[model samples]
Target: MNSSMFNKSNATSSIGENIYHYLRKGIIELKLKPGDSLSAKNIAEQLEVSRSPVRDSIIKLGKEGLVDIVAQSGTTVSKIDLDRVAEEQFIRFSLEEKVMMLFIEKSSSREISKLEELMEMQKANLEKKEYNTFLNYDDEFHSVFFETANKQMSWELIVSMSGHYRRLRLITLWDLEIAEDVMKQHYDLLKFIKEKNIDMARKTVQEHTMRIFAQKDFMVKKYPTFFKEKNDEIDLFNNFKR
Candidate 1:
């Protein structure tokens, strides 16, 4: 291919990636709040790309439950479903607890060293007040454990549920004291896992997931507009009390 054609192809690929990552990050961070309207044309214009790539990105986001396309109205950010989130949390907890147990059994001292390094990074991020960076390292710490255990699907499940917990984490990041407590729990968990204590690791994983789910009320009240209207189906969130 000619140099001009190669450059054009490269630019198109770059635009596609930019559009995808822009929307994905917004959804993951809850910046594109639930039920927020989305427009391919507007997104394309804003990103300086063609509508086709924008449309493709929207479709991809939909599969991830980050966006919704109404038949007649338009595309919109997805409303938070408390029940679904709970279900995902349950599944993730069950899977990851097992993975954590396996990790405790199989991990080496070198792997523990890697985890400690990640924890140190998280601590540094916390000191710097870089909440997002802390999150990245926190994820890395957990992911390394799962990867060491060869639990790819479990890791994927954890990664998937991250978006569900992202908004809550964003809220929690504001409280330095609470963040410190969380960091301490992570440290304890790491120590127990490194000691090859399966029971402690499982309990720690369960406790962590439950703690996250306990924030449901705070999220729902703080962002009432982020939920969908109740249909004929039962609304468990309706009975949720802080």
Candidate 2:
């Protein structure tokens, strides 16, 4: 795995904090991948850091549900938890739908054109086959809605809770068909916004953001081990929640 992403400096954070950030980014961005092994010794050697900070970061990541550390065994990146994904997606859909509707109601054509520019930039990255940059633009496009709607706090909350969902989205976006479909939906979202059609905007958000649930079967079947499977315990807990 290319562990070089951590090299980008954050001067204030401690060595352990930096390791935690690097490992978390790798896990979330699919560089390390679900179920990929991580050794503190190897990581320390690779990073030219001591094992103490490396181990500390792994423990911190484990607490955040991004990694699993087993005594006498090893640490591995955690698989995507669909239950958490579903819950977080619902949270995202609720907030983002309202954000989009608000943006449409209040935004000028000039603001809408700015969104178009972002889409064009995303498209350029896709054409260049740089999916990571494409995903970054995708984030900027959506963030503009929250920023414009004055819901930056809600955006931060959604991001804080969306580690699993983001990982799955990264995996999903790698498919050309799916990526193109997502881009088209983005365009349709802009159309609804330009028309100031709240109903259609709601529909688009529901369809576009919630499409992941529909694709769950495809995702699980293709990458079985990367997703957490449902089981009796899970069903029992869900039933209990009701």
Q: What is the lDDT of residue 187 in candidate 1?
A: 84
- Measured against the true structure, the TM-scores of the candidates, in listed sequence, are 0.82, 0.86
lDDT of the candidates, in the order given: 0.74, 0.82
Error of 2 at 174 (Å): 2.3
Q: How many steric clashes between backbone atoms does each model show?
A: 0, 0
For each candidate in turn, give its C-alpha RMSD to the true structure in angstroms: 4.6, 3.5
Using lDDT as the measure, which candidate wins?
Answer: 2
What does candidate 1's lDDT look like per residue over 1-242, in tens digits?
12232234665556566677778778766678787899999876666667997899899878877789877899998887666565566676777777886787788889989988999999999999888789889878878868988988778876765565565566666678768877988988987886777888888877776675556566567677876555521344334221
Query: Taking the tens digit of each residue's C-alpha lDDT, what string does model 2 give over 63-99?
Result: 7778878888888998988777777787898899778
Name the best candidate (by TM-score): 2
Q: Any runs in candidate 1 off by more than 4 Å, and if so which?
A: 1-18, 229-242
Clashes of 1: 0
